[model samples]
Target: MINWKVRFKNRSWVMAFVAQLMIVAQMLLQGLNALGVTDFQLTDAVQQSILTFVNAVFILLSLMGIVQDPTTKGMSDSERAKTYKEPN
Candidate 1:
């Protein structure tokens, strides 16, 4: 079995995976609606809104990853000093 924690070690990877899942789910929902198995209404505006929200979430996750990266260190002095130190 695949361990999610090991496979998705970074927030960006996790967010991307989630975005893919959302895409698949949206497709499935649309298929179901076409087959008359669902009443889901994904109008252009609603679809655009959902896509925008997902993209925004991806951006936020990427920003969080950048903030916590060992390279960038941190935003403040105290954090920078601590981040530079070798982990024990």
Candidate 2:
């Protein structure tokens, strides 16, 4: 079984997954449009808006992940430095 909590803790991974999902959705939509099943299409302004929204979401998630990282939680500067140091 997948550990959803652990998977979602890394914001970059979540962002990349969402981006791939969006690309797949766009491809499906394009296929449907070509088949004339639906006349759906996005204008340049709408596309720009979606891009901006996705970027904002990515930034917010990144900040939240940084703030919630368990390794550095409640650690003082010296302690954190030691914890993060190379083993060499």
Candidate 3:
């Protein structure tokens, strides 16, 4: 089972959740427009921009999670230092 409390505590997770909600809202709007229930509509460029932004955000957050793995918690300062080399 998922731990909702801990998950919600992470800022990246919260942002991702909001992004997902935005996608859902877009879907609902599109559906309503298709059914002629609402005259309002988003342009193709606007929809594309929203999806691209969300995809980029998810990719960034995934990379951050990879960089923050739990294994680093057990590493000594010297060990951690050895893992990242100084730029030349």
Query: Which of the numbered candidates is closest to the native, going by highest lDDT?
Result: 3
Off by over 4 Å in 2: 42-88
- Candidate 3 backbone collisions, by pair: none
lDDT of 2 by residue, 1-88 (tens): 3344544555655666676577678678768988999987789799789868966765676566633335544533334344433321
* Per-residue accuracy of model 1 over 34-82 as CA lDDT, tens digit each: 8999986878898899878976875776666642334533433344334
Better of 2 and 3 by TM-score: 3
Tens-digit per-residue lDDT, 16-86, candidate 3: 67766776887898789999999986688997897788778767866776323354454333343444433
- Where model 3 places Cα greater than 4 Å from the true spot, the runs are 42-88
Residue 49 miss distance in model 1 (angstroms): 5.0
Q: List the residue pairs that clash in candidate 2.
A: none
**What's the TM-score of every candidate structure?**
0.46, 0.45, 0.51
Question: How high a TM-score does candidate 2 get?
Answer: 0.45
TM-score, cand. 1: 0.46
